[model samples]
Target: MRAAELHGQRHVVVNVVDDVPPPKPDEVKIRIGAVALNHIDVWSWRGMAFAKRELPIILGAEAAGEVVDVGDAVEDLFRGDTVAIYGARTCGTCAPCREGRDNFCEGPQAMYGFHIDGFLRTHVNVPARIAVKAPKGLDVMAAACAPITFGTVEHMLFDNAGLKAGETVLVHAGGSGIGTAAIQLAKAVGATVITTVGTAEKAKKAAALGADHVINYREERVEGRVRKITGRRGVDVVFEHVGPATWEGSIMSLKRGGRLVTCGSTTGVAQSTNLYLLFQQQLRLIGSFGCRMQNMRDVMEKMAKGLVAPTIDTVIRLDEIEKGLARLEARDVFGKIVVAL
Candidate 1:
């Protein structure tokens, strides 16, 4: 088996091992097909695991693979089934997990490619519950982006923000992996999408993805453009993941009683808040983490139907993953970078 192990900051070594374990009673042995790169992978590469973790951890979080072996207790999955592996390790029996709120599980949670060994290897054993089977005929590369990329957007826009049809949404970083997914998903629900991009090229691509309006944040005041686009009103929802750099503007772009849902802090974390404006406007701020297991299924189904698909910026072999991480860290990618295993 071949695996990419991170020993320290910017140190990734691909190792070959002779021994690999089989699946447990409730687990499955997966032959990883493709691994999608996320900002979380960049954070891990930079030695930014916020929690305590041991060194030399495998370095992939979002991936899809073929099931080579299934545990005796796992009847839903079978040999040769293609599935997207969830990044977080949550106790399936926890109240939140049972209630379809897997991200809020009370048990000890560990994120793959961060706190624990990930799927950047030839094979891995994972709990069957976290392995979401992709719809038949969906390409493995596209399925690789579902667990985190599309699922996170699905959870953020619909579950956390309660985004509805006939509404307007401001999605920051519109050229990003999740941002591109947000634009398509929001539009599929009939929402008017306004997105922010850093470059004119990204602005064109964002608009092509069905964004009603695209703002080049580097060239103009985002909040000012957003207000003008809305005719001095504001958007019904704001899909925010870029951190403090855009935090204040994201707040100002939202309408009264509107929702702001955030999932990541790619930029620096802390930012000042206006409590008076928040209270007066009755705005809702939602802090969303990972998605429910069901969100992964929903996105995969959408992918199968050709309603949405991943925007793959590049594909490289596992040994070349460092280049992808560098691109993600530099904000040089338009969508996902997948590693063919």
Candidate 2:
């Protein structure tokens, strides 16, 4: 078997390793087929992890694989089933986990590709409880994206923000994987989408992805354009991720009582907010992390229904992990970069 591991900061290597054994009871052995790259992978490569972790950690968070074998206690799933592995090491006995809010697990921090060995390996044994079956006819590349790209947006827009049809949304970094997903999902439910891109190329791409309006933040005033497009009413929801560079604009672009859901801070994290507006306007600021297992399922179902699709920028081999991470860190990609095993 082969695995991509992070030896240290800016150090990624593809190593040949011993194959994983058969699944233990209540577990399933997956033959990983595809791994989707996210900003987390770039963070790990750059040693931006907030917690302590061992060196030589496997380096992937989102992936889909085939069930080569299942433990005796595994019931509903069988061998040969294609499934997406949840990107967290959550304790199932916790209250949050019991309620399907696995991201808020009360036990140890629930993170993959950071705290524990992740899905970049060719084979892995994961608890059957964490594996969600991919919908039939969904390709491995697309299914791999559901656990992170689509799931995060689904949780942010619908669950946290409570976005409704016909409302307008401002999606920051529209060329990003989750940003692209947000635009499509919001549009699918009839919400008007306004997005910001870093380049003219990405602006055109965002328009093609059903964004009602695209702002080239590098060349235009994002907040001014958003206000004009919304007729000064501002957007009902602000899909924010870029940190300081767009934080003020995101707040300024929202209407009174509007919601803002954030999942990442790819740029520098430090930012100050207007306390007066925050209280006076009754604005809601929500911080979301990873998605629940059920959110992954919902996004996968939507993918199966053609209501959403993964926008893959490129597919690289396991050894090209460093190159992929570099592209992501440089923000050179317009969509997801997948690694096929």
Candidate 3:
């Protein structure tokens, strides 16, 4: 089996290994079909990990594969079943995990491709509990995106922020992976979407993805454009991920009682907020992390039903992982960059 590993800062190499092992009693052996690139991949490549980790780690976080061999204890999965993997290693015995809020697990967690080995290889053993099987005939590349790309948006907008139909939402960085998913999910529920992009090309793409309005942040102010689009009433929710660069603007683009849900900080963290507006308007600022396994199941079901799909920028071979990460870091992609394994 072959694997893509990060040897050092800004150094990625593909290595051939012959020591692949079989699945444990609670795990399954998966033959990876595809992997999706995210900002986390870029951060890891750039040595921006939040925790201390050793070098020469596998370099992928979002992926999907075929179950070639199921453990004896895993009755829910079988050989040749397509499954999307949950990257966070959570302790299933925790209170939050028992309550179906796996993202809030109290036990120590380590993210794949960051603190532990990831799914960039041709074959890897995964815990059956974290592997969510996709619907029959669903695209493997699209399933690879379910764990993070679509699941994260589902958690941020619907689970945490409680986005409802007929509401107006402002999605920042509509050209991003999660941003594109947010637009589609918000529209699927009959919400009016207003998105922000960096280029006119991205603005047009965002509008075509069912956004009611698209604002080029480089040309116009997002808060002003959102206010104008909503007729000065502001939107009901703000799907925020871009960090300090768009934090204040995201808050200003919201309605008096609107909700702002954020999951990432691609533009760097640590931004100030207006305390007066937060109290006077009674705005809710929600910080969201990863999604639960149920979120991945919902996203795959939605994909199977044709409600929403991944907006793939391009598909590259495993050896091209470095290029994909570079594009993500440069913010030069309109959607996900998938690596066909």
Per-residue lDDT tens digits of candidate 2, residues 127-234? 999999998898888899988899999999999999999899999999999989999999999999999998999999999999989999989999999889989988
lDDT of 3: 0.91
| Per-residue lDDT of model 1, residues 295-318, tens digit only | 999999999998888998899998
Instruction: Score each candidate by Cα lDDT.
Output: 0.92, 0.91, 0.91
Model 3 residue runs over 4 Å out of place are none
Question: Which 10 consecutive residues of model 3 have the lowest summed lDDT?
Answer: 48-57
Pairs clashing within candidate 3: none
User: How many collisions per candidate?
Assistant: 0, 0, 0
**lDDT against true structure, model 1:** 0.92
